[model samples]
Target: MKKMSKLEAVLWNIAFPGFSQLLMGHYIKGVLFVVLEFVMNVNSRFNQAIMYSFLGEIEKAEMVINYQWLMFYPCVYLFSMWDGYRSAMPADEKYSFLPFVFCAYFVTVGLMVSPKVTIFQVHPGPVFLPMLFLIPGLLIGFFIKFLLAAKLYTK
Candidate 1:
């Protein structure tokens, strides 16, 4: 197997849930992710929500969104990126899952808070708000990873 770049895997996954898996040579996993992505997107009316949210129609976006289905997205999407990155990298890499795990957690929290959060009295709407939360989540994940590395190295 040719060595693959973890960054490349992450970028592919960003483009589409399963694309990273495909790039990593995990055909079955990739197809499954793609199928899940399509199913969830349709059921949650995600694209419609995005369109409305981008247009500043917060109410319409909320009305069209299926929260239960939409909630699955962050976990699935983040997991795909993590999995692809993990698959491409050496197995011995430490704490590699931290960022993706925390990002998923934070994004979910963002999704939960999307209805009430506002910046300067302007609602961020669905997609963008959760993304904003991801920043903190990623930071927290890296922080934890750093702590773990320090502890392990000192031992």
Candidate 2:
């Protein structure tokens, strides 16, 4: 099987979770991720929400989103990305999953509060709100990972 660079793997998964996995020949996991993504997307009306949000219709996006089903998105999406990234990483690489995990946590929190949270009187809605929160989560997670790797996080 051909190996892919970590960046490529991550980017592919970001485009659609499981693309990297499928390309990397991890058939079962790739198929599973694809199936789950499909199920969650359909149930949550996520695509519609995204379209509405992109069209500057935040209220319509919010109305179309099924929070109950959408709640599962972050974990699955981040995990899929992580799965691809980790697989592509060198054997000695450590703590590489921290950013993805933290991003998932923050994105989920963002998703939970997206409906009520407003920034400067603008509602970011389901898609953009969670996406915006991802930046801080990545920073924090990377910071923690660095600390852990440097032994600065002593018990």
Q: What's the TM-score of every candidate structure?
A: 0.95, 0.96
Q: For model 2, name the residue pairs that clash.
A: none
**lDDT agreement of model 1 with the native:** 0.91
Cα-based lDDT for every prediction? 0.91, 0.95
lDDT of 1 at 118: 88
Could you give candidate 2's per-residue lDDT for residues 94-149 as a string of tens digits? 89999999999999999999989999988898999999999999999999999898
Worst 10 residues of 2 by lDDT: 146-155
TM-score, candidate 2, is 0.96
lDDT of 1 by residue, 1-155 (tens): 34579998899889999997876678899999999999999999999999998888988998999999999999999999998898888978899799999999999999899998989988887788998999999999999999999999999
Q: For model 2, what is the C-alpha lDDT against the true structure?
A: 0.95
Which runs of model 1 end up more than 4 angstroms from their true locations?
none
Off by over 4 Å in 2: 152-155
